[model samples]
Target chain A: MTVSIKLARTVKDLLQMAQTEYFDAGHRTCQGCESAMVLRWVAKAAGPNTIVIGATGCMYVANTTYYTTAWALPWIHTQLSGTGSAVVGTAAALKALMEKGKLPNEKINVIGICGDLGCADAGGLSEVSNALTHTKYNFLILMYDNESSANTDIQETTMTPYGALTTFSQVVSR
Target chain B: MEVVGTGTDAVAYALMLADIDVTSAYPIRPYGGVMQTVARLIADGYLKAEYIVAAHEHDQFEIVKHASAVGARTFVGSSGVGWLLAIEAIVAISTDRYPVVALIGNRALDDPPGAYGVEHNDALMVRDVGWLLVWVDTAQEALDTTLIAYRVAEDPRVMLPVGISMDGAFLTHSEHVFKIPPKSKVQKFLPPYDLGNRKLHPSNVISVAPQVNEDWVTEIRKQMDEAMKNARKVIEEAYRDFAKIFGRDYGNPFVEPYMVEDADVVMVGMGTVSKPIKEAVRRLRAKGERVGFLRIRWFRPFPTDDIIRYLSGVKVVAVVDRDYSFGSPFDGGAVFTEIRSALYEAEHRPLMMNFIGGLGGREITYNDAINMFNMALDAARKGRVEQRVIWYGVRE
Candidate 1:
């Protein structure tokens, strides 16, 4: 039930971890994209029985592009401002339908991943707040603050206040 | 059972009858009424559902969209700018192909200091998007169509979302007597909501609607087009079965032609404008004038066959648009452009003209309808429309 939270402390434990590659290769991310690393570790930790909600950001635009996907697990894309709401709805639906004998009752990890621009600067803060208020729902929303709106040419975002400093620096250098 | 309630209340009853498993709400006038009633219904033990109150319309719509994907019958709605605010989720809902039923309390999407009144422009924005858009003129139709919307949208053939637009004050706020079918009869009429193999459950190991490039975009959009095309027949079936089980059939399933059988001129429009126009039709008929009214029900499907069938014999067609499309071809309204385009292929075409009025919920009086009809009749006799588009009630 708590597969995602299942910790691996020993080298033997890490080696014995599920060999299943949920987050497979062939993504279009830049070298040393730490967000991709987080997605990989989380996808592996959540295991196969997980529904990943990737908010519009670096991880989404990089992987799962046009008839292609690097993830073996079931994944769905959420609007930039819908990471929290999507996960809440998915988890709530799983519980409701399963209880109604519509879907099979089983423990499934619902993971929602969002970037800084999508979750914070793009008015998704309210969505995340509303999502957290639903205490009975079983889900997790991971807000990865990359400090800028990296998906759209790395524009300035809520996490990138120093983005204006770039302009100031340019002016001073001139 | 028959009960008197507002248009929004009628839709609330449909949510209960559909046995929606999840719904989301954020307070905006007109549309906010139904959520209040739905919450009351749940609190009073009349219905069982997950009622999520989000901080804004984005989360509100997103909640229901995703819920429908995971095999839950979901409901959500908004009005005016609230609907506009949820535009991102709204488009995603259609592309994701979840049969989520939404009640749009149609209002003007004006600037910051906007008025709360009936306007079709808010709903017209989705004309290009992949949503099954329909307009309900009465509270009774609102209730029944909301039920039918869920059925049509959830059908395997038409796995798309539906936007049921109700004219703000005239429909959403006005009270009218409507029949609420019992759960047993509704169960007979409508099947259970099922996504089958596409259900986003652990058991159904399928990913959906992932980001795609130019290589994959056309086919995905084409799939929606095919589904929308299939919806015509599926809608007819839903209406037939609804008549059999519920005994209330909206014949034609697209356009409601009132006294068009022997009329020389037909005034066309959607939503509550039909009320005043039908009254004008009767008044004109009494005066020995051959005039009729056609209420367009399904806007997304465009009801081309119904429009061509209903208006072909008529000499002239006058379209009263409650919403306008500035800088559009001939400066006509959205509905006007659609019908004109639909009529372009007809063997027998009527001299068509657009009359834009009733903007910002200004009342479309029967008198206004009378004036428009007279102008149309004059055009039919002249064999040409004197004016292509007229802002009917403008102070000019």
Candidate 2:
């Protein structure tokens, strides 16, 4: 869930050392958006041969705009209830092709990205748990707990703190 | 290849023969029989596969969908409320075109005053999900159709999941003689499930089910319909190959028409209800009545063309439905509404009568089928319709 950052000697050396970057730079995420940064690292680590399944949240809306996509690797944006199951399907299809010798036996990772509401409140956890416990294929589910449903204009959600003031929750001054 | 077994065992044997690699299941009445048989088969090493009992029916659907997505042939089952529970996944897998075979033990939905019995509502709930649905009448048909379902679903042209539905208690629990094809022949008939170039592989990373803009969303949706339309041909080809390999022909493989060529009144239905109706048609024909029956096989990608072609010559068409919609504008059965609309443009349309019966597992005997035929005959002779629907088998 957490990765440590290593300081490189210089930006030129860092760019030279990095051979592949999976997340494109032209996304429209809000300023200081940690979700987009985390996504960049995730896609970078997952490499080019990875399939990313994104749930309906800030990542989906911000990354996949009307005419453009910020995904350099193969990525799919699904509804809140679909990310987990869709990832499993992609992994299953990969396994089928690999076993049938239609596709080479290279290591392909299936990664699912969902928000706090998507994973914890939108009835999608069961789907993730089912895929994890049931399938032999390895799939990683990254729950971006942003403390609120941000795409809906930072509305208060189950993941929001008890006394947070937002569009759906307010403090009445005495 | 002939052996005495229940419908559950027939499906299990077919799953084994088809070489399913994973079976995700949760126990629900009538449908659980297939799970038990499959569990035992996997346990005894007869079927080499991963058999996982999921926490819930929804999980079961997702688990098998994942398994099928990963390139494993998969089998799953549900009945009644379990089907409702997994409806989201049901629609998801179909729209995504995952080729998983679901064995639906048709049972009444949990309406008020709930009871256990066979009803088509459970399977019919997601009728618009774009999956192919095959209604099997006998235990033998259950076995045969399961094999056919795999072929139909896996065809690259029609890569949608298929539902092989059988009436609970009537078919799942009842025993009948079923023929299992030889392993070699089945292998030949059903090649190993191949995704061809349409799979998730690291060698060629591809995105699926991606977000499409409004400009392209309609085309994505339209592709599902086109695939369903493509299924009509794939279904026929698979059934033809099935008949060739097994030597058991099911007439049209979409709709099985009986005694309709020279008949004036024709009855229509699917599943176990058709068995008794077939008998009723035989007896009515013997009694000098020009009567026939059409046992519909594929409900979705509904054999609309075959239904129209076969019923064109008939004078009266009785569509018997075991399920009803609470507030349909047609004020009749679900299938009856479809049948009525399908006949709107026909040059020679037959009089249509809707009979709602057999809800909550009530016995739909041969007498009831005969009664339906007589009603159709009366409507045909009178040349006009009165009551639109008869809730048969209900006591006043």
Candidate 3:
């Protein structure tokens, strides 16, 4: 029911614990992919009690590139606008099982990972906001602010920084 | 207990009797009554459940999906664009196989000249998304179908969501006397909500609705298709159980026939519109026109085999569709298209035609039903329809 992002100090310490990284190696993320790094850290810290849900974004494309999955724990990938809905569904199912005493003494955390495009551009803003507002089935949405639609080759998204050159956002002279 | 209330109220009563663990609601006209009733029940301590007024319809759907996935017997509802707005969640819940029951106060999607009226477009929009659909014609059926919907959706053989669609204003607002089974009987009938092995839990520690390669995706889809096909039997069983307890049976869970035994022309349709068609058929039969009416209660997992069996002796068939499927190669509505497809292989397929009427809650009166029957009679006698598809009740 709690989501906290703690900075794992130093490359030495991160690499020392890399052997236990829940998001295992061998994915197609670009070199310097901030979203990928965030995913690894979040997956590692959240541990096996967590179920991660990813919207149609860079993480979904790169991490789950078919024939492989980087997540050592349960992971669900849904349509761009379905991150909140998917997490809610997973969380609800888990909670219902727990309440019915069917899954005694078991609790599963539901986490949603979505890129900036998913939050603002992929028609998920309202859905995410709604899930958060109605917190009956507690879940968290990690809106990775990568500024661009990195999955679509770094195309400009609404969250893209001004003057940054993306495939769709070039420095234009009036 | 018998109560005189609208269809929405009946649904709320059923939700309470089913012991819904969680439900979220946002107001949509024609469906708002359901949420209001639920909230009141919660406040008065008549219902012990989680009830939240959601930010919007999309949020409500997400809440319902999650709550259900988490092992909560959840209920949610909306109408028209309200339901359409939640299509994202609807499709996800279905694919993920969450046994969430959605009560749709059936309304038309915003046509150019929009109005708050009944139409099947909202439910039909995601008809292929792998959910069990049951359309009710009365407040009584609304209550009964909803109770059955929960059992059917949560059935291990099914494990798919169910949509209880009632016409907006017409069914949603219309008051009728219906019996509400005692909670003890309901408890015995529905049992406790359990996903069994299908639920999400740390003990299981397995992914749900995960990403898959081409080799696995096809299989997953096929698995879902198999589950939907299996729903027909489970749906029928649930109805039989309901009837045994409630003492009111709607003939069959999938489709019900009305005076078709000796008729040569059969008029087919669904939902509240079919109510008047029954009367029309009665009047036509009295005049020796030899007509009958068949109402389809379950639209999804369409009972093609049962329909063919029922229409075995019929000479002419007419499908009255309140929802249009635009650009169909047959240039007909969904029900018509499905009926035609089912009859294609029949050795003695009757002269069949489609009649589109009652869109946006336009009243399809006995007169309209009579006209449709007469047209079917003409087609039966002539062995061909004057027009393959007729837009009944439309000006021009």
- Per-residue lDDT of model 1, residues A1-174, tens digit only: 133565689987688565657787868888887888888888878876799888888888888886578778888889988988999898888877877777778888999989987788678888888888898888888878877777777667777765354222344454
Candidate 2, residues B1-396: lDDT per residue as tens digits?
Answer: 689999999999999898787777788887889999998888887787666666677767866765665567888989999989888778778877789899888888776535678888888888887878888988888888898889888988889999888998999999999788888988878877876655544444455555557888787679889999999999889889988888988879889888899889998887889889989988988899999988888988887888888887578888999889778867888888877777776779988888999988899999989888888899889987677788897889
Task: DockQ winner between 1 and 2, please give it.
Answer: 1
Top candidate by DockQ: 1
A18 Cα displacement, candidate 2 (Å): 3.4
Best-performing candidate as measured by TM-score: 1
True contacts kept of each: 0.75, 0.38, 0.49
TM-score of each: 0.94, 0.90, 0.90
Error of 1 at B229 (Å): 0.9
Ranking by lDDT: 1, 3, 2
Backbone collision count in every prediction?
Answer: 2, 8, 12
Task: Kindly list the per-residue Cα lDDT of model 1 for residues B157-194, writing each as its tens digit.
Answer: 99999999999999888999989999998999789998
The C-alpha stretches of model 3 lying farther than 4 A from their native spots are A4-20, A25-32, A65-67, A83-109, A135-139, A170-174
By summed lDDT, which 10 consecutive residues of candidate 2 chain B come out lowest? B198-207
CAPRI quality of model 1? medium
lDDT of 1 at B143: 87
The models' CA-based lDDT, in order, is: 0.87, 0.80, 0.80
Per-residue alpha-carbon lDDT of model 3 for A1-174, expressed as tens digits? Answer: 465433569897577666677788758887887778888877777766777777888788778766667877766666687666666656665555556465565545678889888877766786676666546776788899888898788999889988888988656668
